[model samples]
Target: MARVKRNPMRGGNKFKLGVFGANADGCLSITRHPDRWMADWDDVLAAAQMSDRAGLDFFLPLARWKGFGGETNARHISYETFTFAAALSGLTEQIALFATVHTLIVPPVYAAKALVTLDHASHGRAGLNMVCGWNQPEFDMFGLTKPDQVYDQGREWFEILRRTLAGDAAFDFKGEFFDLKGVEGAPGPVQQPHPVTLSAAFSPPGRDFAAGSCDCIFTTFTTYDDAKVTIADFQSRVDKAGRQAGIFAPVHVVCRPTEQEARDYYQDYAVTRTDDAAVDQHMAMKKNMSGSHDPAAYDLYRKRFAGGAGSYPLIGTPEQIAEEMIGLNNLGFGGLAMSFVNPKYELPWFLDRLLPLLEKAGLRI
Candidate 1:
């Protein structure tokens, strides 16, 4: 049999680009905008088709079981990631599709099979974002407790998945978190050893886990200098683990014909019409349950959370947004997963306006 090619996410453009959070309502913005992303099946399909045609690098979905309580509840209405990826795999031809999986929520054997199914369904365009579970409320809903050795459990989880995809033969397994007999998966992923894996991690342990297990790391930062520091820190960890992992950043954008118009709209949706209650709920939960941000960010970046779930923001005209993207590329980000207030309306606009700038900057082709 011919060796399967690498997942599109593994390499390509100097700066890869992806559409993030399209599976959830309101994309990433906790806002009261009348036309905030509805996340209906049609809307999700439209966004995926648009992104695929635009030659976007990938389509990444968030794994959210419950909504941050508030007026809009932000991501309350959402599609399950694996199913979302599978559906899109049949519809889109080029863009890679990722399913963000919380290791604790799905068994490793199940995850391995599902990913393989997606890989076959997409003909090797599938990818995985492995998440060590966070969000206590969501955990509560599942009647599961956050294990003390959270990342340790995650490590074991990935090991099982790795072994499961190794071949068709069943094997007994023992571990701190898992014990199984005759464990195995058939029809391993189309991508050789396994499909590409990424993790969004911010804390040291999280970074270490990602560096050790993932092919890519997704991280957040407050400034260019902050991002620089994060890159250096993560690179050190990757080196220590004797692995090479690409670093990706997530950003929320507000682009318009003029910088002022962009800023005004950003203020209108993210501040004036923001879903204050949902942002509060999200902030408090994330601060207490997750190490997904800097400690100072909770208080210092409330508007940021409202704007794009605490991701870095790019608000300006197409040229300005493109420049900011180039700046991130300079800092060594392998790619960006981006969200917008209303992707149904804005994504096409962005493709039409900003893509040319990125191409001219040599970030994409």
Candidate 2:
């Protein structure tokens, strides 16, 4: 087997773009009003096909064991992550498929097998987004006793995952949470050792783990200053760990033909949620997990609704959004994980208008 050469200019060259898809039930925005709804199976498959044709790099479908927001209708209560990816792999030809795997909730060996299976299904176009389980209710649904146990379990899970995905036929891993003896994955991922691994971590331990293990780190911040500081902190940690930071940023977007149109659409789609109960529930979850009733984050959230910009700030005219994307590219981010307002309508608009601009800007194919 040949060694996989790391792209030294991967982060600085151009923006590798991707889209976030609906996993099980449908693709619904947590913050936005549940106005647009795509059919569970056909619409999602079509969306994947559209993204592939649009020269998108990857499509990430978030996994949730149970609903988080108060709105129970759009919450995914259908197929599992691996299953959804498998179906998408059959439907789409080029774009990579990423499934969200909660490390703390899932056994590492199981997760590894699932990813390997998806890689085989996709024929080398599979990835994993490793998430440290944050939802307390989801843990309870799994019969877990305490939320604090999640971090320790996640550490152990990653240990097993790193070793097992190496495809070593005889690997021994003994940890506090998981113990395996000479286990190896069959039909190892076509992407060398395994598929691409990603994470979204803001805390110190999370950042350290991402720097050491993940192929990309998914992050979100309200302002450019906040984003710069966050990226700098992560890069510092990566440097201290003697590892290269591959890519870092969130995977959401809002692009339009004009800046006013983009802002109007952003506010109309995201900020106009009529279901206050769902928003409150989401806020409560955020508070409990991170103690971040930080008025700043909320203010930023409001700004996103008000056409200002939010955590994943890629709003403006095509040229302006492209410039922001270039800024991210310069900041050692290898990819943009993007999502649209209403994928059925907005995706085609993006492909027709914004993508051409991005290509001219040397950020896309």
Pick the TM-score winner.
Answer: 1
**Tens digits of lDDT, candidate 2, 1-365:** 11223211132336777766455433435444454534357767777888877867777776667654555433545457777887887777777788888776777888888888887777778888887857777778888654465556676787787677787577887777667788776766778766777886666677777887777777666566766777788888888878876655554466777789877766766666533455456555665674322346764475342221124657777678777877777666777666554566667767677677777778765
lDDT of candidate 1 vs native?
0.89
Candidate 1 lDDT over 1-365, as tens digits, reads 22235566865678999999999988889999886998989888999999988989899999998998898878889999999999988888878899999898899999999999999999898999988958877888888888976889999999999999996688888999899889978898888899889987788888999999999998889888888999999999999999899999889988899999999999999999999999999999889888899899888988899999999999998999999999989999989999999888888988899899998989888
Name the 10 consecutive residues with the lowest summed lDDT in model 2: 1-10
lDDT of 2 at 279: 49
Number of clashing residue pairs, candidate 2: 1
Regions more than 4 Å wrong, model 1 = 1-6
- Using lDDT as the measure, the top candidate is 1
At residue 79, give the lDDT of candidate 1: 90
Q: Estimate each model's TM-score.
A: 0.97, 0.87
